[model samples]
Target: MPNIDATVTIPADATFDNTLQALRRSPLDFVSNLVQTHDDDIVRLPFGTQDIYLLNHPDFIRDVFVTKSSYFAKRKDISAEGSYLQQMSGVLPLFEGQLSTTYAPIMTEAAVNAHMRWDTMHQQRDFLKVDIYKEVMQITLDIVFKTLFKVDMQAKAADLVDAIITMDVGYGFDPIAALLNDLAPPVTVSMTSEAQAAHSYLLNFMLGLVEASRSAPLDSRSLFSWLLKQQVNGQPISDEQIADQALKIIFSMHEVTATTLSWVWYLLAEYPNVEAQLHTELTNILAGRTPTFEDLPYLPYTEMVLKEVRRLYPSVWIVGRFVRDNISFGRYLVPAGSIVVFSQYLMHRDHRYFVDPDQFDPLRWTQEAQAARPEFSYFPFSAGPRQCAGRDFAPTKDALVLATLAQHWQARLAPNQTLEPYPQKSFTPRYGIQMTLHRR
Candidate 1:
């Protein structure tokens, strides 16, 4: 359209520097403001040749993540400049297609349907519902354990609960590994004690996981085991490959699931009416019992709530890609090598598609309402090929956790404490959310 290759330089002046500073201070709010301020699909950053193109509009998002997905691949390494932050959150080289193919059946809508049926009829016994946030966190941890290690770490759960609490602690925010991933081989830090500590901790932890998996007998259910059994033209996966994949799975699952659950409680507390309606739906459907996969079809309200939470606070809020070649979509062309971002936070909040976009209304997800909107307008887990591999399991687990906890308890935010959303590893509460659980 309008000179696709025409690019402008973003200087290291106050405008650019201050913006970066603001982002470091409050990334989510900063990005939200960025979305509102910039109209250009792509803006050149002082950072480098890799421009920051905002993919907030659904039409544009569909073009980037779905329609023209093959044109973009996950950025080889995220940050252009060297920083500790980018390393921690960089693209992980995990087994992609095989992992997706293996888990697809288990995480499918049908599998969810079957699991819910079994859960509702038989498996909900002895299940005293805990706080929804705690329950989801536990379930994610369980899933990670089963899928990654093929073993439940719960035998040591109580002790290990805090062990991995801040597993990514060494690299501050995004981690240096994520930043320098595509650069030269991993380098040692000589600057701060913090950096050194983080490097040591993560390296050791990864090494241990690798050693344990290698020594242990293979288990079919675990992801590591699945990888071990696989041969790429009769060659086994390398130790480094195994460790990297394991780290990716662990990091992705824990932070995202925990943060999503945190927002779930926050939203439920903010909207008493929605909570009441959700309770009514769950109670009417399950009749004072835990929800199962079968009840998912009947539990639209629960699904809506989870969808709403995701809309407001997507675990993987931003999808990043580096363009491999110039691509034309709609009226514009995104040149090769541009760093494109498709943001769920921006897309979900855009006024173009949603009515009263800022408000959190779960009812919009009702079959009738959803049917009325553009298909690509709703994408918390993204859309198309590179959409989250774990997207399918996330909602079912969220629904189960929410329904189970809501069945017996109502959790309320602690008095006089204001909790705001901020992006750390995931969408975490800027200040930790304190809640007092009242038994219902």
Candidate 2:
């Protein structure tokens, strides 16, 4: 493997210090700046003893995520180890297969039920002002709980949501922390007290569900029941393992989907033309009725809008992998033990791939246009074998939710508020999106 040339390195001097400060202040902006400043497909950053390589081009991204995927592992030293879905990598096939089938109908029902709830609320008033993120989060939480555990979680929704939020804050990524971990011997990153408490609450909650399922009649459709049936070697998986898996699944399902849907609402409010076009399609197709999974195929524009939103504000904005072996991008070598990262944020907005990249245009997702772009250029769910387990489930739910909501109501951004993307555990709206809903 050949050494990377000086041109690819982001110099570790005053400029690097300034870049680190920029990173601490705003990681998204830091990455965006890096993309704009560096022309190379692979840019190297010096972090302590470790070299961090940012893969900018789709070809390089394809090599890391697909072709030479065996040479890399999820970077446990950074935040990848904390990822619930990543931790459950082995069961990804089950999620893609059996769990997807079980989840689809539940997701549709939940979407319809949410629409009905909004309908009941709309009866008292023609318009309502609400925080759209909170509204979407609650809906997604309910859907995840019912689908995963066959339990209605509405009553416990408030506390559960709080717990998740606390955990997110506790587990928020810090590059400095990561650098320290990289330089020092391996150690567990301690969660904040509040986050630990939240973790315990969630763990206990899942454990209770797992224990209850032990005595309850086994349902082939239930995720827990299915897990209980599985044997590792000759022994059945323990309650603790089942509970942990359930907790991870619940967290991954709700948070990512809710964040994505929240962005959809905010983006729609900001781009009325796109929203109008979406409403037109929904009206033409569903005719003021709720959408079902079957109706999603005919709702191409609705799907396009969701795709566009994801492209702009992907829930999982950044992915990191630890290089296990020397990997080459042409003549340049990314040495073993270095961290390789790719940003969906930067790739989706690259000028070479997307014309007027900042614009919220659903037309870019048309089959013809999509076919013209590199397959790795717009992966909001990441890519290859390790792509999101809920890839199929999420889009269907989002389209149905958006279609159902758009058929009857329009959400407008409230006046006098700045909308910014805060890249936390997920790309979240820094200030929650406040919107006024009108009867459409």
Tell me the whole-model lDDT of each prediction, alpha carbons only.
0.60, 0.76
Q: Which pairs of residues clash in candidate 2, taking residues 3 or more apart in a chain or in different chains?
A: none
**Lowest lDDT 10-residue stretch of candidate 2:** 176-185
lDDT of 2 by residue, 133-207 (tens): 777877888877776567888778768977877776686556434432333234345688899999999999989
Those runs of model 1 whose alpha carbons end farther than 4 Å from true positions after fitting are 1-22, 40-44, 77-136, 168-170, 174-217, 229-244
Best-performing candidate as measured by lDDT: 2
**Runs in model 2 with CA error above 4 Å?**
1-24, 75-90, 98-102, 170-200, 226-242
| Tens digits of lDDT, candidate 1, 1-440 | 47644554343442545644564566567667766666654444432435556565667778777777777765454333222223222322232332344432333322233234435643445432333344344456655565446564544433333334433343345422342233212435343455555444555666676778788886545567655654445698687666666666666677776777778777888899999998898878989754556778898888888888888787866666667788755455667776666567777776777889878899888788888877777776666655665566666656666677677666677667666665643565544577655546
Candidate 2 to truth, TM: 0.85
Evaluated with TM-score, which candidate comes out highest? 2
